[model samples]
Target chain A: MTTANAIRLRYALRRERFSLDVEAEIPDRGVTAVFGASGAGKTSLLRCIAGLERAEDAYLELDGTRLDDSASGLRLPAHRRAVAFVFQEPRLFNHLSVEANIRYGRQRRSDRSPAATFDELVEILGIEALLTRAPSGLSGGEAQRVAIARALMSAPRLVLMDEPLSALDAARRQEVLPFLERLHARLPVPLVYVSHQQDEVLRLADTLIALDSGRVFASGPLEALLARADVPGLSGAAAAAVLHGVAGSMDDEFGMTPVESRAGQLWVAGRHPNGTTLRLLVPARDVSVSLAPLSASSIQNSLAADIADVLPCSDDSAVLLKLDASGVVLFAHVTRRAVAQLDLRPGQTVFANVKSAAVRPVFAESPPGPA
Target chain B: MTDLGPLLLSLRLAATTMLILLVIATPLAWWLAETRSRLKPAVQAIVALPIVLPPTVLGFYFLVFLNPNAFAGRLWFEATGSTLTFSFAGLVVASLFYSLPFAVQPLQSAFETIGRKEYEAARTLGASPLDAFMSVVAPLCRHGFLGAAVLSFAHTLGEFGVVLMVGGNIPGETRTVSIAIYDHVESLDYAAAHQLSAILLVAAFAILLGVFALNRRRAAAAS
Candidate 1:
């Protein structure tokens, strides 16, 4: 119920090849990730919001300000909309030095406020060394960092990033993720990030909108939506429930970090400072249904849980059970045979056993909350 | 030694022609590069016609068009109280038509290479359309501008048929280096023809070399 800023958008575009109709209301603070497979209309939606693309009948509002209304014939062009975009390709001006490219956006502000200074952004993005170099000389990762810095420099009402990390290699992606996390924490501007990467969504998103074939399949808090029993196929092969936890104690002797959450204390493979908030993705396939808590087991995290709902999978050979462990929701993907043997039903108490190594920890800047 | 008047006039004519062509060709080329209208093909064909049509054909049409009896010539006479044909201004008019493709094609191709992505990116970054073109598109297409300017100037410098049909051989007023070299050869001035022809050859070679050098550097930087 903590409502401060929000973005509401309704757009329908008809092209020769395909048409997209999507309506979503997202938090206007933190990172709201648009998650979907390629050609799912994710980029098109972002382009419409940025005013780079248009729709016949559309409406867009940010923080209660009406930016576009087709019914009223009120359309703000892209340059006047004050939305910054980070394209997939770096798209840095080859004729400009890194400093000039970053400065391009900053110089366009009507009011010259030092809210986000060039030096500060360069430092945060770790592009200080590249300030004097040309964009052609920088590696892929360095150019992307500079692109992010340039977008941030604009002091925009909202930032739309269209698969910003998709162009980089795995090694380069790892190098730039921390800077993005820092940006998420420090900047007050709302961000609409488009990505199909589950790990990126888990780490950065405060709200999630899943697009499937030009429509919103699901839209809600990242953790709750991913744990839904009704949306079984939405998660695909890597069906997992995201848990928001704080790093508790670092067990260097074992090289594991104990993450405390509503579900239980789970040990993840990492070393982090105490009280650092992180996201953990517990794969549904990694959890096993147990009639009672065993005294000794290879699984280190076992929590008492009550089955909330059970839905059959697409293949019908498996069942996805939504479990409520204390106050947290966890998903358990178990075979239909196991479900029948265990007699799993709604409101029935059981233990969900998860291995210590099954938890994938995500470094998130801010936990999902209203405004 | 060779009077130098014709060489200087040719340079002046080429410079003036390039300046006017740039002012007109930039937007025309940009429109050709970006528009999806049904008329795009027709406009593009008209712009490129000068490249394939024999220079004399264009010169013949210009001769009729620049006559004081024609509408364009009458408009020129009313505006300046002077005749259009057989004047320095007539040569300029003839040269613009003769060299338009040279100015526009390079620019159009250059504009095409920069593409729409960068312009969209600039818009999202809060640049107006004009600002985006000036800041991003113009700089990115610098080589195109260079090629267009050089080719148009060089093409105008050597203009022979169009100048002859439209401006005639009026010394110090319309006769350019090409006409001057022609006059020398017609009068059996072998030494003068060789010297002027060698000068034109060297200038053309140096201009083409510079353009090629620039293209090589751009390619190297891109890779």
Candidate 2:
């Protein structure tokens, strides 16, 4: 499969004390999650792209269109630019009713694009009953749904979500994230999701741009960048990678998506798009090793990979193995118990059995690694 | 027997004065609440001046200014063929000046108390400044406007020195409720004074009750 058009943003933007220094490129076709700590300037970088904040020496081009280039002093105003931003707080207009607030951004779009129907959005967000209520009356989840609906209505070329779920509690976040997944899979516009949570980015993003102290720490395919043991906070135990696959056949009776990946046939239980790519993450600790592929197992996925490295840390209790499949590096933490049982050794061909449900997509990079 | 002439004249003067003040104060208070002009503090202090000055001081200035011999008085006399003092119009002017601050400060403070972040939210969403002011600021400042109106009306109803100096208590031409009560008291007709005092007390209480009742309605609506 070919990669879609993307944005290339390079240059430095400095202010008196806090400066946003960056060099990065994100695909124009899918979600590019900016993951960082609270003060790592993730939101500032988004704001610069959205034209909400001006930055000197900031060069940003989206799919070949020059949106901001400060070397020659070129920039677009927030409203004039093709980006719509959803702040951490819902920020719905209090004087307006829910319906009116959703329509506020809809009225601002000058170009004709495929807009999410008002009814569709309200239905998807489950906010049909809240149309006439004032913003003051909405609960946090409901208000965020309205915010998301409002932002989507603008038909932006690139939508910026600045910690949209950060203000929500866990249960509420769980409720909204699935809707976000479905929305991203459905919408045509690219998204730049900014978050501090690695789980969220792992579950949602196609491209991950990890920032540290206002600099790009790593930028690439979410799974590939994250799978490497060298990724700051993601090393050893926390290392995880996103995997993309297509639904091969329906097993509705068993409730599984038969995914066709280079890792071999993997079956994950969910309602997945038939042929389109679905992203899922496989954490480092979740995989188990066996010299021979077990056919009688209950686990769904058994992938064939070559052992890339075997780092034997102090404890014979466990070992870190880097398995390479083409250009992808997947990590597995085998306990000393399993290593001895299977007689696992370096350069040995092995079958790594990972539960289909245990796999999830790379959504966000680990927080601004090491401050 | 009740004197219908003075009561009717007083009611009419009070009604017109309050109405004009409401219209004038609404916009002035709105501006005072939002604008950060260099002149705002001075304007606020001046609006509040009427509350502290003796009514006679305020009235005497108006009285002199509106005298036919004075420049303003001569202009009105030549232009409208009306002398300034001892007229219903002159009492209206005096009452308005006296109650101006009562109508402004509460509203200004109310407007100021509303957070600026709310307005900024609307602006980034593509609302013009005027639209944000009308849609965001005005609705939030509703309570202050009501308070100012109630206070100004009640304060104007109790005016004495300004009306006495500028209105001259002409029975049907310039007299007000306060002036009528004063007239009865001065005449030493204890019975009449008591009757007028009872009526004024009831009126003030009723007016305050209505303000409070309306405030409750506004609160419910806001919620």
Candidate 3:
């Protein structure tokens, strides 16, 4: 497989208590985060994609090459499929030294483009001191780092990580997460990171597949998917909004990047120069609506947007507003009193006044062009 | 009182049994643990039958039926020797049947506990069946191999009834430590019997205790 626009999976598997029925296409691009709760069949879905489980009529294709297709009875064994998997646990062989495990994957490659250089990955994951130790001797985080390096060393077409960080404590997670981010940003292989944590999802994923009870509840670009508050990990007030805009200018006085959107100019605190596409998260609760545009306010910019739709909230009159600002869904959860006071109605134009402090700026650019 | 021939024979038999069993039991146990094939339980039961069966009954079947004028029996005699009835070879055969469970059970449980996830991980990493087994399964379950080895060695060292039935009481050929102790007691040599029995007990205890200590060490490390 030549690696761009890879995996396609459409399959059904019946278990005792649940049936895994998911249809997904993993872009042969950057990280695709599979977000779900514990026991939501996240691991099983990764397993199926990696060719660990056999399902009937399982039509799976990677870069136009059929891995499994019952139409012609073609099933490529996992070893032949060129998919690297990082399991929840490190699963490192106790007998092999750390270098050996890393070399294990490198040795499996038939054609090597750029091997995840031992020194580079060891430095990247900070596993240099662990080279001589066996897996049984390494700490959990250390073992997992070695595991990731090993998977990368193979130079496989796609890498699948099944909750690779859930076992770590918060501090260890923080330590490893940046290395993981670096790995994805640098690696040539497409990565499929399976995680339930929203922070991990937002920090890493370019595309998202939110799994709920053995089904793909939602799957799309991370910006669009994270905008849906009803998506499990993207819930309540915290994980509601993803805003992508192009940098227009840097305002030294206000310390903000003048980001341009279809909604209008947004004053966001970002370090990028003019004309860099960026993605940032704005939680819905952070966004409050003002009927009239305010000039003498601490809030940065007021953009015009039409209310797209509304859904009932806890109270009878209170509702969740889906605002369309240049095709981006910005959720605003306001009480019924405010809704009536603002004279909010679907298809009615209103000023969306948001604060510069409200937007949590993230360094994001478009998918790297195919090399 | 302490002629070391029987002790040497016991060590030889135990070591040989473990070596042979490791080759046979590993794949058998791995398959038993991994496959959902039908007749699995039935096959496992058959392998485990010698553990539960009366030693005399098992010895009776092996001694009489195994050496019949039948085609298999003639072939066995011709390949090895006509004197298969009372030899160290015969004792080794008897010990293998008697000690099968001690080796197979630990290895089977160990292989079972390694779980499908490790194999799945290895498979996705481009390791084939043989590669996964050597690199992943075998190393990950090292304690099981140790337990199986120690159990098989000690079990073979303690073989008495099956050896007596299948391997006649020949001093150098068939007489293991347990058999030698039995001979001393039967001859009214109480002091010699006690000495030989004490040595055997100490050696067996040391082996078993070492295994349990390793098991505890593994458990402690895990916790």
Best by DockQ: 1
* Candidate 1, A1-371: lDDT as tens digits: 23546688999988776678889888778888988878767788889899988897789998788889999998898988888999999999989999999988778875645347787898889998999999999999999999999888987889999999999999999998888988887787889999988778877787888877778888888776777644423453456788878999899898888889988888888798899988787888898889988677877788899998887677678888888998888888888899888788899999998877888776655654443
lDDT of 1 at B166: 83
TM for chain B in all models? 0.97, 0.85, 0.94
True contacts kept of each: 0.79, 0.27, 0.79
Who wins the lDDT comparison?
1
Write the residue-wise lDDT of candidate 3 on B183-221 in tens digits. Answer: 888999898888888888898888888888988998897
**Residue-wise lDDT of candidate 3 within A8-88, one digit each (tens)?**
878778767677788888788788998888876777777777888776548888778888886788878888888899988
The TM-score obtained by model 3 is: 0.86
Clashing pairs in 1: none
Model 1 bad stretches (over 4 Å)? A1-4, A110-115, A367-371
Cα lDDT of all candidates, in order? 0.86, 0.75, 0.79
Q: Which ten residues in a row have the lowest lDDT in candidate 3 chain A?
A: A362-371
Please give the RMSD of candidate 3 to the true structure. 3.8
Q: Give lDDT: candidate 1, residue B141.
A: 94
TM-score of chain A of 1: 0.90
Give the poorly placed runs of model 3, Cα more than 4 Å off.
Answer: A1-4, A35-40, A94-99, A126-143, A168-177, A196-199, A210-218, A223-239, A246-277, A311-317, A364-367, B1-4, B35-41, B78-84, B189-195, B212-223
**lDDT of model 1 at residue A16?**
73
lDDT of 3 at A323: 81
